[model samples]
Target: MCTTADESGMTTLPEISLAKLTADETRGEERQRLETACQEYGFFCLVEHSIPKKQIGQAIEASRQFFALPQSIKERYSHAAQNVYPAVARGYGPLHGEILHPEAHTDPKELFGLGIENEGDRRPFAGATRFPDEASAPGFARSLLALQATVLNKVVPQLGTALADMIGMEQGWFQRHFSPPTLMQRVIRYPARGGKCGKHTDGGFFTLVLQEELPTRSLQVWFRGRWMPVPSLPDSLVVNLGDMFQALSDERFKSTPHQVAHSGLSDRISLPFFIYPDIYTRLTSRQGRHSFGVAEMMLRNMESVAAGNGAGRAREL
Candidate 1:
C-alpha cells in the first residue's frame, strides 16, 4: 500500500507490483488486492514493472523534444487543420483545443495522440498512425513506438488477464474482444497553474498513465466526496479503471472521477494509454442486459468533448 499526506490530508492507493502480480507465489493474493482497489477507489500505482529503463527515458526525451518545437511548427500537426476529424484524431491539438470538462471554462492543455497502425482494419480507431516526419521530430516516432510496444505487448496482457479474472471471464477473453484493440496513446502537456480539467471518468475499459515525476501532486481521485491526491512513486506508473470496466463488472468496480489540477510552477506531461475493446465489438453488461459498442460510446463522448461540454461517462479514449 502507498499512502501520502500533503496539505490536502492523507490518501491511500494500493501499490501493485507487476513482478509479484504475475509470480506463482503471489499472483492470487495480489490479484485479490487489485480487485479490492478497483472496487474501492478505481485508481492505483503500478510499481516494479520491468520495461527497459532506456526505453522509458527515450519516450520521455522524445516527448520533451517534440513539445519544445516552435508553436508554428507544432501547429502543423493540428488535427483540425490537417483535415483529420475530431472523433478519432491521431494528430496534434493546441492548448484549450480539448474540453474534457465542459463547465471548466477552457481546457488549458495541448496534446498529441496516436495508435492503431493497422491500415487494413476499417474500424473507428484502427486507422493508420499519422506521425510527424523524421525531419520534424527526429527519433520521436521510434522511441514512443518502442515504449508503447513494450507496454502493449508486455504489460497489457498481464493486467488484462487479471481483469478478466476479476470479472469471471474465461481464458483468452480479452483476446477475443480486443483482437485489434482500440488503443490510443495520448501525450498531454499541462502548462503551469490555473487549469483544471475537471472531474470526469474515462470512457474506456481503463487507462495506464506514465506521469512525469513532480513535486506537486497534479492527479487526484474522487472518493466519498473527498479528493485523494495520488503521490509520485519512483519507477511507477498510474492505472485507473473506467466506466466500461464498471459496467462490465456489474458496477462492482467504481469508475472514479479524476482530474489534473495545476502542476505547481512547472509544466507536467502525462502519457496515457487508453485501452478499449475492438471498435466494432459490442459488450453486454454483467447482468446480461444493456449492451454497448465500443465505437458508439467513444464517438459520442468525443463529440461531447469537441462541443465544449461535459464529457459523458467513459468520455475519453
Candidate 2:
C-alpha cells in the first residue's frame, strides 16, 4: 500500500521481487502489489530478477573501462560525429552533450548508446550502432550486447505480461507488439559538477536502471509536490514507467518526473535499458477511443520536452 504522501513527506517506493511474479505460487499476490505500485507511485525497485550478478558487474566494469580511455580514443565513436546513419540514435555523446532543459544548464554527463543493430532497417531510430575498436577496450561491445540481450529477452517481457494482466488484457497481449522491439542501452557517467539533468519524464514505455551503489543519493523523483531522493540500493534495478505506459494505461498509471544531480563525493555510472514497443505498433487505450503509434508519441513528447513546453507535465500519448 505505498501511496502518495502529502507535501510534507517523501513517498516510499515499494521494492518488489520480479522472481515472485514469474512464479505461479506467488504470482497472484505479486501481481496485485505491482498493479498497486504502478497506479500509485509509477516507480519501484525490482529484485530477484533473472539477470546474473556477475554479468551486471562485468557490464559496469566494461563501461568504466570504455569511459576511462583517452578523449581522442572515445571520440572515434561520438554519435554527433560518426553517426552516418542519421536515423540511428546510437554511439557516444560527450560530456555536457545534451541540454535536457533549454532554460537550465547542460547535463553534466557523458553517454554511450547502443540500440538494436539491424542492418538496412529504415524505421526512425533503427540501424546498426557504431562500436570502438577492440584495441580501445577488448570485448566491451560483445559483453555489453550480451547483457542487453538478457534484459530484452528475459526481463522486459515478464514485466510487460504483468502489466497486460493488470489491465485485464489477455496474457502476452502487450508482449506480442514488442516483437523486434526498438531497444536502447545507454551507459551514462555523471561527473561531480553542480549541473543536474533537469526534471523530465522518459519517452518510452519504461526504463531499467542498473546503477552502482553510491556514497550519497544522486537520483531524485518528483512526488508529493517535492523532490525526494531515491537511495542507491545494491544489486537492484530501479524501474519506472514512462510516458507511453501512462498513455497505454489511459492515465491509470503515472509517468513520474525524475532527474540526476551531482553527488559531490564520486563520479556515478549508470546503465539504463530503455524498452520501446515496435515503432509502428499502435497502442490503444482500454476504451478504444485513443490510439497512437509508439514512435509518433515518443517524437511528440521529445519535441515538447526539448521546447520546454509543459516539460514537467505528462503529455497525451
Candidate 3:
C-alpha cells in the first residue's frame, strides 16, 4: 500500500520495483499488498522493468529531434480528418491546443501523435499506427518501432496478467482478448508557461508514461479528492488505469481520476503510451442476457459530460 506524509503533507504513490516482486524471495504478504494497491489506486510507478534503459533514452532523444522539425515538415504526419484514433489533432499540437481543466489553470503545451494501426488483420476493428517518414525524422521509425515492440512484448503482457488475476479471471484471459493489441503513442511538449493542461481522465484501458526531468511539474493523479503530485521518476514508468477498466472489472478496480496541472515556471515534456481495446470491438460480453456496449456508454457519457449535465462517471475501469 502507498504511504503519505502524515504531517499534513500530501500522499505520494508507492514505488514498486518489478525485480523484487518477480523474485523468488518476495513474500506472499507483499504480493497481496501490491495487488490491493492495484485494485484501489489503479495507478503506480514501476522501477527496474526489463526494458533497456537506452531504449527510453533513445525515445526521449528522438522526440526532441521530431519536435524540432519545421512546422511544414511535421504537418505531413497530421491526423487525417476522418481518423478517430486521436480526434481534432493537428500534425503537432501547439501550446494550448485544448484545455483539459477550465476550473483550474490552463496549460501551454503542444503535442505530436503516432497512430498505431496493425496490418495483416482485416478486422475493421483493429487499430492503426502512424509513423513519421524517414526524411522528416531520420531513424525515428526504427527507434519508435523498437520501443513499441518492447511495450507490446513486455510491459503490456505483464500488466494484462496482473489485471486478470486482480479480477478473479485466470491468468492470460485478458491477454487472449488482445492477441494483436491496439495502442497510441503521443509526444507532448509543455512549453515554459504560467499555466498548463487541466485535470481529466483518459478514455482508454490504461496508460504508461515516461518523461524527462523538467524545471516544472508534469503530471498529477487525483486520489480520494486530493491531488497527488507526480514528479519525474527517472528510469521508471508511471502507469494508470483508464475508463475501460472501470466497466470491465464490475467496479472492483477503480480507474482513478487524474490530471496535469499548470507548471508555474518552466517548460516540460512527456511521452505517454496509451493502451486500450480496439474501438470497434464490443466491450460487453455475449454471455450476458442483455448488456450495454462499452463504446455506446462512452459516447453517451462524453455527450452528457460535454452538455454540462455529465452522466455521472462510472466507478471502476
TM-score of each: 0.93, 0.90, 0.79
What stretches of model 1 exceed 4 Å from their correct place?
Answer: 6-8, 81-88, 314-317
Query: What is the C-alpha local distance difference test score of candidate 3?
Result: 0.62
* C-alpha lDDT of candidate 2 relative to the true structure: 0.76
Candidate 3: TM-score? Answer: 0.79
Question: Ranking under lDDT, best-scoring first?
Answer: 1, 2, 3
Error of 3 at 231 (Å): 1.5
Query: Taking the tens digit of each residue's C-alpha lDDT, what string does model 3 give over 76-100?
Result: 6655532443243223555545545
- After TM-score superposition, the amount by which residue 284's alpha carbon in candidate 3 deviates from its true location, in angstroms, is 4.6
- Which window of ten consecutive residues has the lowest lDDT sum in model 3? 308-317
> On a 0 to 1 TM-score scale, where does candidate 1 land against the true structure?
0.93
**For model 2, what is the alpha-carbon lDDT of residue 121?**
77
Leading candidate by lDDT: 1
